[model samples]
Target: MGIKIIKRQGQTFKDKLFIPAIMGGMKTTLGHFTKNLKDVSNLTTIQYPEEQPTDVATNPRYRGVHRLTKWEDESEKCVACYMCATACPAECIFIDAEERFDGKAEKRPKEFKIDLLECVYCGYCVEACPCDAIRMDTGILSFTGSSREEFVVDKKYLMNNERAKDLSND
Candidate 1:
């Protein structure tokens, strides 16, 4: 599709007054203020590290850590297409491919690594996989690492990122 430019209109008397805008902003703010005033549970912050996360994300659509899914026979689902690396805006995924000995046309990833430091957690990589190999529904919200090296996780680690059992139930 070609770019279309719309004509701009100059500010009118109502726009210049700012009272209506201010009132509208206040209405939105007061709505949230009253909502939070009724519900105090949302304001409680869990002290992380010292206090382990009691509740992980409950949303099924929640995207947290990445996981490399497997086939019915426990074979890797990734075909080493590199679409994930190509789709990644942050360029955090690195994969090395080798021909599969099982007489498959698609090659397997000899080595796969993802740098959490560079990852934006946008989930584009999961979307780019044609085999439905990668997913971000692990429910492991809080990932930690003391060093940059620890943040750069490999295929083995990604393969182990199973969804929490409690989260898997619902």
Candidate 2:
């Protein structure tokens, strides 16, 4: 008679273990599915504008909006140092430095324009400010423009925002 090898028919230890494990995994997934459908945990969403989250204020070092700070005389805090421009990964900050009238010791930006369209909100400019003139605290997360030209914000526009004025609270 030819040698006959019988194939393993019954469930082996690995097979038995794997089947239960799969069933357990499926059960866990189904549990999650049912829980998700109910959503009693209140962990999935935010109330947005009405119930503004406390995460930003809680995190003191958190960077939010971009602000072009001003001096006591209401002049720009920016010395036209160009550090922000250099630090930008998106290359969005553009400055035109000019000596103040009557010849001040420091140069000032005659034309400080930031292309918001190109800005990645990386907060590099805020960090690069040596004079603490520029900050990310206006809390402006969204901006819209009718045209590309409108998106290129000038110094006046950045410093003149209503939200920025609220920062002073005077």
Model 1 residue runs over 4 Å out of place are: 1-45, 50-56, 103-105, 168-170
TM-score, prediction 2: 0.66
Q: What is the C-alpha lDDT of each candidate?
A: 0.85, 0.76
TM-score of 1: 0.69
Number of the top candidate by lDDT? 1
TM-score (all chains, Cα) for each model: 0.69, 0.66
Per-residue lDDT of model 2, residues 1-170, tens digit only: 89999897547887766887799999999998888889867565777765665555435455555668776677887889999999999999999999876343378999998888888888888878888777776655456668999888889987875343334342
Model 1 C-alpha lDDT per residue in residues 10-96, reported as the tens digit of each score: 478887888788999999999999999999888977677677564556666677888898777777888999999999999999999
* Number of the predicted model whose TM-score against the real structure is largest: 1
lDDT of 2: 0.76
lDDT of 1: 0.85
